[model samples]
Target: MQKELLKWLKDVGELDSARLISECSVDLLYVDTLFEMSSDRMTDLMDAQIGIPGKYYLKLQLDFQKEIKIIETQLMEVATALGMHIRSISWNPKIDTDKEVQMKISIIVRQAIFDEITLNKISWSGRLEEPDFLNRIFDLSKMPSFDSRFDNAYDDIHKHRIMNYDWEDDWVFTDRRFNLLHCEEEIFLKFLSLTINPVSRTDDEGVGQLIEIYNRNLSESGIEFYEKSKIAGKPIYGYREIAAGNASTSSADAKQRKIALVVGCSQYEFAGLLENPLNDAVAIKQNLESLGFDVMYAENPNLKDLKIKIDDFGTELEKYDVGLFYFAGHGVQVKGLNYLIPVDANLKSERTVEYDCVQVDRILSHMENAKTSVNLIILDACRNNPFERSWGRDLSQRGFAVMDAPKGSLIAYSTSPGKTASDGEGKNGLYTGELIAEIKSVNLTITQLFQKVRKAVMEKSKDTQVPWESTSLTADFYFNRK
Candidate 1:
């Protein structure tokens, strides 16, 4: 790329004639006026070196003695005009002497410039602004304090295009630009976005079809499975996984054969609804460990912390043959995307919902990539959000729903999509109570358990609240049926 740029530079004009300064250095300089610079100043900074017929390059730099905030403000303006956006920033600090700091700064700036030029949405014409005079305004308050701001700034720099993308384009960020910015021969390029294509996903509709399958197969033991009953210590058909695995592993000194993660959130501020999903998590953990499965539990994890936990679990997932993720909490479907809420989630806006809450797809991505042979996700989170209650939205809205569970995975929801589940007045949820009953029964596959749970919940709720399941299991699995 540099070779091409150098060649392009030689053809346009004399190197010194265009006020071009190659490898220019600055000292004790600070740039504070970048935020308030006019458009002409930016034009001046463009250094006006034409490239490849009509293209241009702007060599920009922010020095150590300059205020990062000022530099950021100026960059944003240029990015907006040029139809560029910032994506992210990864920085390494220099703790050595002043000279080392300066050298590191130059390297960082040069690398950033190279990256920007090579980026699909941006082109480097030349040094539009001088680095020498611009480095003197080092006001410190313009820098960001948190990592998110810096990351956002970089994202903005990389992303700020005037146009949206086309449907046929690859959605992968690394493959192509999300925005289009091309220069016409007359320099009449306008960053205009194309219309967005409608989303074609209809998986939510499939949940209803799945419900019919369960209702049709409700009574007969189409696939025999069950939880153990306490009174007779006999296995009953349709037990949840945690119960069977927990019971068998109890007395054995050997490591538990399977591991389960139970996540729950109940203390919703708007409605003040509480079912103690955490308490259920504790119960499930203890009972599962007793039966032979190593149980790990997290209750109402902060939204900020959930991803870290998920990532950590992703690594540990390879350790077990079977991986189970169970979530019981409030869920909401927004803009066609499903979000699992943390106790701290405050989604006042649709955009906020997408970023802060855990997306159903992200969880699937981790699980599908995991090496575990069996991946089971059990969600009992179908409570309604209080903030949207007054908006006249359906109260029957179920929590998050997932589609297309991978070939080795099973996804069970507490209630059908677009329907709400009841928080049992009893110790556990109605579905969980039945789940606890069935899991104690040995020799049940997850498919059978889900089918049975669908039956029990439908029957127990008088056909009002139906459970849902999506599975692509390739092998039979049992906690204690053997």
Candidate 2:
């Protein structure tokens, strides 16, 4: 049986079979002995094997109790064949012997992809042995003339569009290569659902083109798009950190200071929720900049832009003493996993989610590497899920569930879990309205101000909603501790 199972596994590409066979151990064995082989040479061993079933298969009569044992044995055999290491096993004698023994099993495999795959850490390079410099030209079969290319003679022409043909092997090619490299990086990074770090490999021109390409691609899908610009004269990065007791600015020349990233993504990114967060992100940039910090602010950014913002924010994090993130829009927690809704996210199926939408952990992972003094993740994106129908189909437990926030970080939710918050029948939602009203109060500390904001919003909503927070704060945090 082991040999057969090994062969089956080997025929496929599943190398895990070898490991399972090496640690082979039988689990959940049941038996009712009644052996009758061809001319029992086991007549002497027959009496002893009466209560105990023999290991080898022979003429076995499966009685009521015997059939139950047979079924259990078959289940164990199947489990072993499938390369499952059983952690626990059980048997039931009370179950009806005449009734068929059903096998219901669950298999879980934990494969570590993030830790094992050293992404973006390795750079690839290759040099061609020789160059074909004869200017190899192909026969332009059924192709159009260069003169009438655009409209007249090119209706059915399938061609590779090389925008900058002159830049194939020159200085422009080098720049274009960098641009293409950044573009490729953006594509792969999107696959991993990570933000791009702008400063890792500095190419202002390359990155700018990359952003243009990303947005242009997104626009083809009928999605409305906007790219964040630098504030005043300074460029904006995304969510970052500062020490709790520290100020965003110092008394120094302030010219040497680098502002943190203030990035926001509210996939629920409704036109309604857009203005407040965008305004809030802008206010955050201005407030931080006034204190001598160089701010990188992004609002309602799509996935690619968000990744770029995150990457840029990460690179700038080491240069700053403070960081902050304020997201206002629609967010949902499914099976305890949080997701930031994008404006175009129509997640009707679970299969489409990881690719089409953004996961909160991806955002947090980018921030996890920040070297700043404080990291504050403020999520104002707590509203009822639009895909409420999906919740019922995929979950036993309803509503969004909380995930463990990263350490040394303070996470504030717009509303408490399992509770729905108002979408602001007026201009801003109740939460954002209160937040905007309270955020500028220099008299209050960050935490105290949050408490006040939470109280006010809760009271204003008539106890229908209440804000929540989860913090693993190492020290005190204050917007104006001094």
Give the TM-score of each candidate: 0.47, 0.43
For candidate 2, the TM-score is 0.43
lDDT of 2 by residue, 245-363 (tens): 22444222233434566655443433233445555556556666665566677766776776677677777776665566666666676656777666667677656657666677765
lDDT of 1 by residue, 1-482 (tens): 12222333345543432222222211111112132245534211111111211111221223321322332333334334443333322122213344422211121222332243344232111121111111122222342222354343223222332122222121221211211111221111111000000111123223222222322232121211122232233222221223344545443423335777777777755446676676667767776776677666777788877777777777777787778887777778876667788877776755677776888777777777776778888777776665574445555443554477888888888888777788777888887777777775655555666667788989989998888887776555655544
Mark the regions of model 1 whose C-alpha exceeds 4 Å error after superposition: 1-256, 269-271, 390-398
Per-residue error for 263 in candidate 2, Å, reads 4.6
Candidate 2 stretches with Cα past 4 Å from truth are: 1-260, 263-293, 390-400
Candidate number achieving the greatest lDDT relative to the actual structure: 1
- Candidate 1: worst-modelled 10 consecutive residues by lDDT: 188-197
Candidate 2 positional error at 218, Å: 54
Q: lDDT for every model? A: 0.50, 0.47
